[model samples]
Target: MDLDQLRTFDRIVRDQSFTKAAAYLNITQATASMRIRALEQLLGVTLFVRGRTVTLTDQGMTFLPYARRIIGTAQEGREALRRVERGRVSIASLRTLVSPLITESLIRFQEHYPSVDVVVREGRQGQIAAMLHEREVEMGILCWPNIDPLVVDLEPLVIMRERVPLVVAADVAARLSSRPEIAEVLALVPRVIALRWWQADPETAAALVRLAKTSVELPTGPARRLAIKGEGLGFFVNSAIADDVKAGRLVEIAPVDFEPLHRDTAMVVRSLAALERPMLADFIREIALECAKMGEIIDDRLDKVVPRKPWPKPAIPHP
Candidate 1:
């Protein structure tokens, strides 16, 4: 009758074991049994055969479809209510671009809708899109430009297209300057990398081999530290090193003459739903505005296409 009973009933039927279902549901076996019994009594029908096999009876089979439908409907209802109550908006973002402007936009959104809760998970551009497609998250911020077919809505947020030029500690740069051969330089240097986030293409890699003093790789935060320590030059988004460039902790080396990597940041949402939730829609709008305002400096293109909606609402703070 209730969601708890329906969930327990569904789990029991799916798992075919009341004990297993109870464990899965994080409840005691006795409570699971009582709930099922109560549900069966309410319907006045024996839904499950009382045996080790735990098979559904004829009556159970008849009620199975309805039970599933009930459970699904209940789940949808719960998700909707939670969305409304928490003003919860789930978003996945690339780790590099959670800047002050983005933070301000979120703060402003919360000021308008105090109940809204924002959850941000960080991943690569491709992975963020995948999360949206799977419905694991409602929205995504990604680095790549092209919209995938699976995306229900797309808003392009442009960011500065600052190429992560290679950089090294001043001492390291000085030490490597004398009689550098492409191979020798690469062998001497250990490249710092931001693990999975940095999008270094193959051509860049090959060119780096020819010019890099060593191919040292490190995780993003630590990689910055290593570069500061004069370990080796690493490729990273220009935003990541802005402070160091200003403070003289690291220096950009001679042009690698590599293709300039222009990353187009986008807000991606699944296409299936109409995004009827006001809180979620508002959250998306805030991000879109932030991107439009800040991403232009990097020549990042922020674009949004909703099949039905002809135009986005003007940027206005929520009342």
Candidate 2:
């Protein structure tokens, strides 16, 4: 029999009166009687004795435990499903952006949604893009100017803009004039260091070839380290080396009339449908907040070399 019929039967046995059972279950006495009758017909057995004080039949006694267990198990299963749905969020992000942009936001998110499990996967932009297309992750934080066709459906939120600066060791900068010509700086540098992705772009590759001899291609961390040691000139996002700049460990070389380079820091999802989840939405908002903080940090660092304008308002306001 159905769960409602079983519940009505159990309630009737407990109350020992159809009238009282109906009242307890918020149903009319006639409806409760009909449900009991239907349950008995389904099982082909009588469940109760009709008397001044009702009592359970042999069949009712045999079935009571099974009915209780079935309802309890079903409720447990539903609750388990709900917990699984509410308690997990998966995000993929670029290796470089994770520390500067995501770390603080993730900590804040954990504070707010203590029960929610946050899984962060780190990869390069291409790898993150592939994971999104394969449905391996729900959200991604990455560098913009990505033209991959797989990410065509990505709904992007531009959280920050990363400034790429030509940096050298402080000692190296002290040897040269305060504002050296681009050619003079390039001629003195032993080699150029850059991320592998920079060489992939034709225009950037050509520019690098013209600027200096490309001696090393490494991740942001190692390249910054080598540049700080005066081993080579490094090109990197300002956020990665902000502390170094402030501490006088690294110097940002501003060439005469040099055009500043920048890339967008974006958070993306596969589709608008992904935003329907409250967990994902809240996590995204936290990421945005963290990115805004990082933008300020980057601005402060960049301000040392060139004055920066205030950031524009965000298109999407947090709810």
Candidate 3:
């Protein structure tokens, strides 16, 4: 039976008088009687026996507990929604953006709202675009300068930029002085694994491809790994390589011809209206804060981060 009918039956049973129950519920006795009649007809069993004092039939006693549980569960669900104690959020992001920036943002968000669950899927622009179009996720992060969303419905939430560094493994760095000319560095370009995120710069891409002894394309994570292992030299965003440079796993070499390059990163959502949701909005704030912090770190190291000035190499004896 419906909630109204179930509630009427419960009120009558609790008060043990149809007349009194009607007054408590603010309904006429005729209305209460009509509700019980409808509930009994739906169940195909009488719920009560009418006499000088009304009492439950065997069927009413059996159904009471189930009705109470249904009401309690509905109330609990409403309370959980209000508290956001069990909320969930999902997003699609560029795998390249998942370093100390996005990953650190995830940690910050969890620290603040531990009860909220977050899911992140990494993909290229087309794949993330598809995910948003299918309603699989409400947000996506894109590496910029070549960024244009595939879906018209998507809207930008945040955009961050940082310098790009040309890094080689520590062992590779030992072969050259701290500030090598572009031609000197090119002589050692044995392998290059590049991310195609910069489709806007075809001339530069052609030059890199032609200069490298062996050039191949790979995802950011794998490319970073290969660069760390001395397998190749790569151009990477400072955020992705900052720790590597500090840890001596990789070295940033200032090459004379390579211009001071920077990469822009953007976060987008399915719509501006999505930010109206409290949980989504908070997530955006956490991520933006992390990105801003990353920008500050990048800015502080701007001279060394870009090839504009000589990068001070950690002392490593010449090979």
Best by TM-score: 2
RMSD of 3: 14.7
Residue pairs in collision within model 2: none
- lDDT string, candidate 2, 15-41, tens digits: 999999999999999999999999999
Per TM-score, what order, best first? 2, 3, 1
Off by over 4 Å in 2: 1-86, 197-205, 296-319
lDDT of each: 0.67, 0.76, 0.74
Q: Residue 202 of model 1: what lDDT?
A: 42
Worst 10 residues of 3 by lDDT: 298-307
The Cα error of candidate 3 at residue 147, in Å, is: 4.9
| lDDT digits (tens) for residues 1-319 of candidate 1 | 8879988988998999999999999999999999999999999999898788688989999988998998888778988888767557788888777773368778877777665667778776667777877777887767555444555355443343435566777666666655454444445557534334343454665566456444555657888888788766666666678788778888776543445443455565555253566566666666766665544545432223322233334346579
Point out the worst 10-residue segment of candidate 2 by lDDT. 297-306
lDDT string for model 3 (1-319, tens) is 7877878898988998899999998999999999999999999989898998899889989988987888778777887566545677888887767665567777766765666778788887778778888888877777543345557755555667767778888888899866787667767657876766553644655576677888878877788888988888777878778888999999887776766666676777767777655666666666777778766322222112222322233344469
Ranking by lDDT: 2, 3, 1
The best candidate by lDDT is 2
